[model samples]
Target: MYVGGGAGNVGGAAVTLASRAGARVVATARPEDAAEVRHLGAAEVLDYRSPDLGEQLRRAAPGGYHVHLDTSGRGLLADAVDLLAPGGRLVAMTGLGRGAAELPLGRLYTRDASIVGFALSNAATADLAEAAEGAVGALGDTPWRPRIADRLPLSRTAEAHRRMDAGGVRGRLVLTVGAADGR
Candidate 1:
């Protein structure tokens, strides 16, 4: 299960990777992003804004999600724990403005589940290079591709940041350097 499907950066990659690995992928996003999430290989897309989101998720994956990737990190760890299968793992990649969310220690221990935090910044350079190489190799044989919402010139970097900060920017906002002709 992937949280923040609308972001389309980490969440989109999670959907593609999980599906490619033969997992039944489920994602959460705004209603407008449902179709896109499905296109990214989600077997089920739940509207995160719905009041009955928990119930809907339960219905969608009755066996419980074996893995949960939380990209928004907006205090969803507790809920994800409740929806996890025994010995399931939840990885959180981002938290932005959120602070100090409560974790259900009792449930986590009882279910034998685990929550892990990840940050690329802390990765070793060699590991990063290896992962990058693997990603490039995989791209050659897979239908998975990064979605680019907009490509802006380097001069418009501030504008790009503003657009991202305003939310609703799907995929990535690319900043083009130098000339388009590879000069």
Candidate 2:
């Protein structure tokens, strides 16, 4: 599996999960996140921000990946499809541009590749709360661990959201939502 994103919450979690699932997982992120992604068990980490990102990813996944999960969007999607092997599957989870994408159909037809859209809100239809707990439990014995970028008091959640919105936040931005006052 090849996953693209690199420096956001969805990208990080997908890296860990894909690695744990025994894929020959190659992940893409910015230069600053390569080490953290390696620690997450990625076999190779490419710089997604590089001007030659498509070429870099192709090099890392020479045989091409059967599956590609994108937490970014279609600009990257266009590149990701170029890396697809015949019959490859690409799933995009970001509503980066209203969740609608414009792809080059000729290539998709030639490769016989399929692109699917996903929204995690769909998790609400299933027993996802339990499933999430189960997923976390399944990994307890493994080396997987999410890094916390910052911890702030509950009242500071506004600032946390602001920082996350402004971009460039890595790992997880944890809001300590329930600590007693004056602790």
Candidate 3:
């Protein structure tokens, strides 16, 4: 498995989940994110900004990846398709470039590859309930504890957004949406 954008909170969660699910995951990030990706349980890390993305990914997963989960969605679906073996699956969740893109549909069909857009809210109600329960249970596990970068008061929301937009903070940027005292 190959997980793209494996440095941020969501990406790190993907890497950890994939690893815990017993898949050998190779995670990609920027050059500065190598350590964080490794800490997230990536067997290997690739710098997406490098010119040798395909080469590095192939080297990391010699048999070709069976699945690709893209979190960045920065015009990576085409190259990701080329990196997969026949009958592989691409799960995309982000729209960094735009909400719509022109993918290589013919190539995907020819190779029996599949591109699935994930919608967390689209799951059946019962399934969602069960999954929610499972998630709540999983939270009790030590490894599932959310990594909180910092907690800021609501007054600093603008600064929090700025820091998040700048992509400088690690882990989750938590904001105290409401105060305990009646304000």
Candidate 4:
């Protein structure tokens, strides 16, 4: 299960990659983003704002998800722990940001589940290049692709950053760097 429906490019990429890899991908997003998330390849898209989100997730994947990738880190650690299958793994791709989460250590130990934190920037250049090569190779047959929210000329780079900082952009905001005809 991947959390972050309206979480922009990273969330969209996770859904697409997981689905292309043949995982039964479930995702959470705002109600308005449900359709887009599904189009991105999520098998099920739950409303994160729903009061019964946990129950909905439980019903959707009764056995629980084998893996949960959290991007928002909006105090969902505990819930992720509860919704994991035995030996399931949760990976936080973003920082919790001065927030403290109370984990049920006993449950984690009993279920043999594990939680890990990761950042793509920590990977070696060679590893990143290999992964990029694999992604390019699979592009033809897979549904995975970057979701562009908007494209602006290089002159508007500052505007793009402003929008990003304001959290108004949905996906990626691309800055066209060269001529349209290809320099």
Candidate 5:
């Protein structure tokens, strides 16, 4: 399996969860974040921006990935589709850009590959609970903590969004509902 955006908040969590699930995770991260992504449990961490990303991905798992989770959404669908094993699934969560992104339909269809994009908040509560339970089960006795990159008060909500838009902030950007002190 492959996890894109392996260093970001959601990606980091995905790596950890996927690892705990006994999957051999090959993930991509920025050069600086490679260590943390590896620490989170990716068997191999590659630079997402590498010139030969396709080659690297192929070399990492020549048989191809059964599942590709794209948290960063860097327009890797075509490349991912090329590397999908039979009946592979691509879960693209972010970077659903306004402009059209081309995909290799012939290849995708021939391999019986499918692509899906979803928002976690849109998931049913029952499903969420089930996933949470599974995450806990996967952890065994290990403790888990979300990777938080920044914390801002509610008053700066717009600023937080801007930071997210800029795509430089790493991990989860936590926003307090109010001031640090009760207000």
Candidate 6:
């Protein structure tokens, strides 16, 4: 398994989930976050910004990855596809960088590889419920936990957004509903 964007919240969770499922997950993260992503259970964490990212990934799983989950939203499908094994599945959990992209149909078809786009909004209600239930059930046994870097009353929501937009937030900012004056 190859999980891209291992340092982000979703990417981090993917690492934990894939690892807990007994997969040998190789994840991509910022150079500064490599160690932490590894601790999250990635067998190897490569720097996404490296000029030789694809090469490193290939070396990490020389046989090719059976699954590639892209959380980076960096239009990495081409790179991901090149790293896939026969019959591999690519899950695009976020943006493909733009509106359209050309597929390498010949290789894709020949290898029986597939690309799937996933979003909570498009998920079936039952599937969502099942996943929620599974998450609730698995919480106790998993080491994964949502990181809360800051807490502020609902009144400060804009401030939180500003911080996030400015890339100042390292983890989720919890907004607690409270009085208008922010008790």
Best by lDDT: 6
Name model 1 segments beyond 4 Å from true.
1-7, 179-183
Error of 2 at 97 (Å): 3.6
* Decreasing lDDT order of the candidates: 6, 5, 1, 3, 4, 2
State every prediction's TM-score relative to the real structure: 0.86, 0.82, 0.78, 0.82, 0.83, 0.87
Give the residue spans of candidate 4 off by over 4 A: 179-183
lDDT of model 3 at position 64: 73
Q: Sort every candidate by TM-score, greatest first.
A: 6, 1, 5, 4, 2, 3
Write model 6 residue lDDT over 112-174, tens digit each, in one string. Answer: 999887888888999999998987676546666776798988888899889988975777999
lDDT of each: 0.78, 0.76, 0.77, 0.77, 0.83, 0.83
Task: Please report how far candidate 1 places residue 131 from its true position, in Å.
Answer: 1.0
Record all residue pairs in model 3 with backbone atoms less than 3 Å apart, i.e. clashing.
none
Candidate 3: worst 10 consecutive residues by lDDT?
A: 138-147
lDDT of 3 by residue, 1-61 (tens): 8888887666777787778778898987887878867876789988888787788888887
Which pairs of residues collide in model 4?
A: none
After best superposition, candidate 3 residue 122: deviation in angstroms?
5.4
How well does candidate 3 match the true structure in TM-score terms?
0.78
Encode model 5's per-residue lDDT on 1-183: one tens digit a residue: 899888876777788888877999999988887888888889999998899988999999988899999887784668789989889998877765646777889999999989887888898999999988976676545433667888888777899999999976757889887556255
lDDT tens digits by residue: candidate 2, 152-176? 8877888989998998676677767
**What is the C-alpha lDDT profile of model 4 across 1-183, one tens digit per residue?**
655553356677777778877887888887787888788788888878788888888998899878888775553677788888999998877754647777788887678899888988899999999988876776646555676899988878888889988975766888887785253
